[model samples]
Target chain A: MSFDITAVVNIMGLAAVAVFAISGALDAARQKMDILGFMLIGTATGIGGGTLRDVLLGNVPVFWIREPVWILICLVASAVTYFIAPKLASRSRTLIWMDAVGLALFAVVGTEIALEFGTSSLIAICMGVMTATFGGIARDVLCGSNLTLMNEELYITTALAGSVVYLLLNSFNLPNSYDLIGGFLVAFILRALAIQFHLKLPNPHRKD
Target chain B: MSFDITAVVNIMGLAAVAVFAISGALDAARQKMDILGFMLIGTATGIGGGTLRDVLLGNVPVFWIREPVWILICLVASAVTYFIAPKLASRSRTLIWMDAVGLALFAVVGTEIALEFGTSSLIAICMGVMTATFGGIARDVLCGSNLTLMNEELYITTALAGSVVYLLLNSFNLPNSYDLIGGFLVAFILRALAIQFHLKLPNPHRKD
Candidate 1:
């Protein structure tokens, strides 16, 4: 609603950038891309969501363009991950957990931004989901991973739920911290459960 | 510099959308993508550049959002291509020529937009290149094509040259028509030459 909440979102956003950057860097390494590829994919994944959200919300110059610290962070995080991927290869689960946290945070952040821009709840929720998931989607597209692999994933739904929960709590005029933390917990727990149980949306159209 | 020029660019831009949409649809067909894929890729290709330009220039809601006729055109063009690609499989070169025209027009249009936004000539030139090439890049990324393969192509350079030529002519305060037509010709001729002679940027990293 104000500068205080925006500041909170900015602080939490850094963790999202780090995990997303790492994920992008690892994908580049698997494809035998050079440093250029590492940086390109990493930056794209880290900022792609927010960029899309900002553009749709009519926010010019975008957040990263305005401050540039986010860009620097993505570049550094991705570069560092490129060097550490082999060592962290066996610890991939740690990366996954971090990714979940990023996803949860992005959902709330994106929705908050859209609402601040005076958009309707529906559009705000869409932005939230896009903000949370577009990074991974772009990463997959760039890496040429199995494109349909996400068709049955609950990832996008989790983001939507997270955003909805945040808005719901905020509508009750709850403290910003309560809404933020509750939304984060809602998203994180749901995603963790999905990951733990290997939960998937059913697809009758699937040949298998 | 004025409404007259903007009108001409808008007219030419439709052609760009059609060709770009067809290209996207063809790629989707090759990938065995569904109708949704065809539409998604087609729209992305048709409007991707202008949307990027608008976002950067603080032009909110974008041209398409302002007048969705362009979106309809892209969708219709893509659908038509989906139905006709099999019949036109051997005559794809016609499609290539149309693509060149679109590329040329996009370069000038993008440059014009940047200049209108009060950007420096250098930035305007970059926008031109982005407008001309980003659609195809998005298509390629979606299709999982080899991204670096374009590095050895003259595509982006052609866009850059075309844009610079437009800005140079505009600086002289030439008749707007002259600059627009000249820029289009410059881009089209260069691209046509490249395509005809199988010209490519030298790959210093090439093994062969």
Candidate 2:
């Protein structure tokens, strides 16, 4: 019951890239940034995590370096968002839900890539969490906001949950589709519920 | 003529950490940030480049993980700057000079580290530029300014010059101290001269 990890990774990567690009455009729109700013944010969000991963892996000709389509996608996404954002401004809730989907997909894909490179489970999980959250962190920083690092958010936790689930399923030689679906479902559900219920982890520095 | 790359690297790293911490503190003082903000900015500036390098290298425990002193140094530096900054506020030129020193030191150190890790010469030069500039980029993002990346200053060019010089010296099997001194001198001299002459690179998009 071996899985073709590469194919699944590619699909997940493309999905994550598109979702993050849109998210970046939305963030820029919220900040009232100019068109160039929006495009920059979108490109950064789309390629930032993959670039980090490739650099760590010592993979030359980083992802976007080889395939320029990712840049085109982000540019188009930013342009489209700029013109259509007014109509979609009221759909922040929907965008949040889609972002959860993207987060889950990216976490699993990142973990798989790390595992493919022979990283330990702990390192894989770290990679997964990094891949899932770094784009958002970059967007927040660029937009002049303190990242979720200082806050009690379930962001990394959700990614960790997906990573763990994916690892466990793969350990038992589960079907590839099952592993992907199962991992994404767990993360997406947890994230959606957390946002819906306003669930947040208790800050360690806060008085109980 | 063999060289002790490790020793030179260590000195450059320490110098980078110190100068960047000071720069961060000065920036925080300019913004009148609170103590926590000062410490955060200082520590980020001090360790941010190394952290990025480590993440890219897939190095475990990152640079600051083993060294608690770096954090202490940044904290102390921030405290010192907070108290002394008001008196030094009139000397903005001095602060800028210190930042240039930090940039030179970081560029040399980062290039050496990347070369030691077996990266190509081009990659090493990129690393040097990243190491020298990333801290300021992070600071600017946090401070809600776009001046760092958008400016046509000699910042990145100086770092690139230092890195290329270091690589060439190493290729010639020169002494480690010679390369270090040479690299730092090149960067510092170029940067200082640029500032003194008010020289700037032509913006690619600017009309003549």
Candidate 3:
């Protein structure tokens, strides 16, 4: 946990939260929500997964509540997005790609954090997937999406794949840098490819 | 707490979870979601509030995860509803009233639990309102309701009022049974009256 290493991780984490918050804000705008709703969903999407992880692990007061800066960042980012979403619609696809980067970063970092908390690797992997996907899930749910019926994306799949890859790397006692890069690439690329090719998992509700 | 009292509380808690599960399943049926969706939302709504409560309080592993029977009950109740939802439509109003009962019970119990956990009175009260409303919120969100725009009746208002009353009684060093009964009556009566009269809070977003 050298200062420089921690600094890099922290910066990446902030970026992930910011992008997620912006996306959440965009979602709120699409739903024609009030400003308060925008900020609420933004904050929820940014910190929700980690919050759930910490809570399940008995780490109370929650990270955002304890450290006000994260909350501030999420709210600020969301407000900014609310103002910019209309102008960004045509370019929204670019934003989703950035979200993929955040998704990948969060999946690996979330798992590592859980593992550091002394949870079993299995739980850590679950944490990774949840941390990566739960924020969007919460946002979608709040936006009134019949989530089960709309379950046609590779969203969770990308997260699980990255988490498994990260864990596999860790099993060999590889350098932290290696696992970090390898896992991020796997997740980011997988998600990016999915989005670009309009990849979708089969929806059980849909008749073939 | 005495064993007999604890037993009473546990039974009440189980009933609350069961009714919430049934309501959640019914919501899924309304949306035509698959059986998997029904169980997912059912379990989520049933335990969501307690999970959120424990996380904020730093109590980990969550109540349902620790005592899995709660999850079992929620899933089983939901499964039953999946088969009976169509027939239950005419009787569904009765079920909503049952849900009101659960809401009242959870509001007081949630407050008491938070107080037992040594949270500040204000935080405990917030927990009570959340524990009562969040389950329904999750279900509505999963069922694709525009919640804020649909804010009506005495839903959260009753929970907040009852939690305040319960906490006030506790401040006087009243017996737990008395607080429980008083709070439940206050919440249930307020909610039932609202439903019977078709009362609604002003919809701020409504256009003239």
How well does candidate 3 reproduce the true complex, by DockQ? 0.23
Q: Which scores better on DockQ, 1 or 2?
A: 1
Better of 1 and 3 by DockQ: 3
Instruction: In model 3, state the lDDT of residue B36.
Output: 54
lDDT of 2 by residue, B1-208 (tens): 7667677666656766777887777788778898878888877887787677666655547767878876777788777777787776677787778778878888888888777877677667766877887777777766767636435357767887888887888888886777877888999999999889966654322344
Clashing pairs in 2: none
Tens digits of per-residue lDDT for model 2 on A26-125? 7777666555556667767876776777777665455553455655676677767777777666787776776788789888877887888899989888
| Local lDDT at A92 for model 3 | 78
Evaluated at residue B134, the lDDT of candidate 3 is 86
Give me the runs in candidate 3 sitting further than 4 Å from their true place.
A1-98, A118-130, A137-152, A157-208, B1-3, B25-44, B51-94, B117-127, B138-208
Fnat of candidate 3, please? Answer: 0.43
Residues B65-103, model 1: lDDT tens digits: 999998999999888877777875677888888888898
Off by over 4 Å in 1: A1-8, A147-153, A201-208, B1-51, B60-133, B141-144, B148-208
Error of 3 at A57 (Å): 5.6
Candidate 1 chain A lDDT trough over 10 residues, lowest sum: A145-154
True contacts kept of each: 0.29, 0.10, 0.43
B34-128: candidate 3 lDDT, tens digit per residue: 56556767877898888788777766777764666777789788878877777777897888888888889899999998999999999999999
